[model samples]
Target: MSSNQQSDNVLSLRGISKTFGAVAALTDIDLDVAAGQVVAIVGDNGAGKSTLVKILSGVHPPDSGKIVFDSKTVEIPTPAAAHRLGIATVFQDLALCENLNVIQNLFLGQELRPLRLNDVAMETRSWDLLRQLSAKIPSVRVPVASLSGGQRQTVAIARSLLGDPKVIILDEPTAALGVAQTAEVLNLVERLRERGLGVIMISHNMADVKAVADTVAVLRLGRNNGVFDVNDVSPEDIIAAITGATDNAVSQRQARRKEGLSS
Candidate 1:
């Protein structure tokens, strides 16, 4: 994307730090998610990826730092605040009502209540949203329990869009999905980008990241270890960053070999 496009970033974080008692979960972290771009956050366990997502979703308030949404510094004190600010997050659990059908689940808590509940309009919009994402669900009247893993993922994603969020965060979207199902979810991700929405995906699958992410940010021991352009950096380099071994003996030896070859 061009600099102008980047300048229209929907979300930004600067000097964001979080601590739980004595354990520092994050340290001076910085990130940016531009419109129509997918930024994947990859890290090993205890790398503070979950903490960062919580901070962004207002599940946990940051100890210190600034969160910039749509060019304005804002405070996200709670989940409702995050939603009101046009930020939505779909966690791994999905939190869907298994007994409810697609349309009912989509409008669950925020239903058009106290106004005769516009089932006709709500169902219509639900179909429209599914169509927009190219989702493959046989029927909107079937319970979520009957849907496949990938179909459930699509529903979770589609529900998040009901708020018309500018930035959406997906946590392990393709987890537990079969090869075909994984492809389905990835296609939905691309559609989100095509709609000019900023996507921040937390995924451990390198292939998925490489396939859809425009940029990858590596976190190590709760700090910003590295950020790389997907097209410019190799998977090895990203792995090195994730493992905090970019300057280790093995990497140094490899570097020396390359230098010798060049000379």
Candidate 2:
């Protein structure tokens, strides 16, 4: 995947720090998500992955840092503020209404209520959004509960695309999915990049990272270790970074395997 030099980046974070009750959730975190790129963040259980994304989604604020979007530094005080800045996050829960159909769920919070919703107009617009984003969801009439895991992810993603956001954050998009479903979701992520949207994905699956991510950013404990091009780093190297041994060279288990091979 090629990095877009001409395409302006949509996000910049410098010296980001966050804490909770004297425990540091993040420290000195610096990140960049350029428009038209897919950045996958991976880490171990306590790697502060959630904290970093929460800051991006406006669920939490950085104790000290700067958030710059589209050449302007801005404070994201709330989710609504982030929305106004064209930053949309599709969280793990998806927050869909179980009884509502796809069309209804997509327009849930931003419903066109005053003039009776004009179902035709909404569906038409929804169709356009999904088509523009190249989302793989086949139908828009089924309840969100009735959709498959991949389709549900597609809907959640589609909902976020309604406002043509510059930055889209997705949390663990394929966490509980089967192989085929995971493939479907990753394909949708690629589609997002094709549409010129800056995508930041938090995922545990390295295979998905290798498959869909252009750049992989590793967060170790509470600080960002580095960002490397997916093609330039091996999964084993990423594992080491996430496991907090990025520069030690030979991890113990790898040494043991090497010694065994020689024996």
Which parts of model 1 have CA positions greater than 4 angstroms off?
Answer: 1-6, 113-115, 246-263
Please give, for residues 67-115, the per-residue lDDT of candidate 1 as tens digits: 9999899999999999999999999999999999999999988887547
TM-score of 1: 0.92
Tell me how far the alpha carbon of residue 248 in candidate 1 is from the true structure, in angstroms, after superposition.
9.5
The best candidate in terms of TM-score: 1
258, model 1: CA deviation in Å? 11
lDDT of candidate 2 over 30-137, digit per residue (tens): 888898899999988889999887888888988999898997899988888999999999999888887999899888878876567778888988898878666677
Whole-model lDDT, candidate 1? 0.94
RMSD of each: 3.3, 3.2
Q: List clashing residue pairs in candidate 2.
A: none
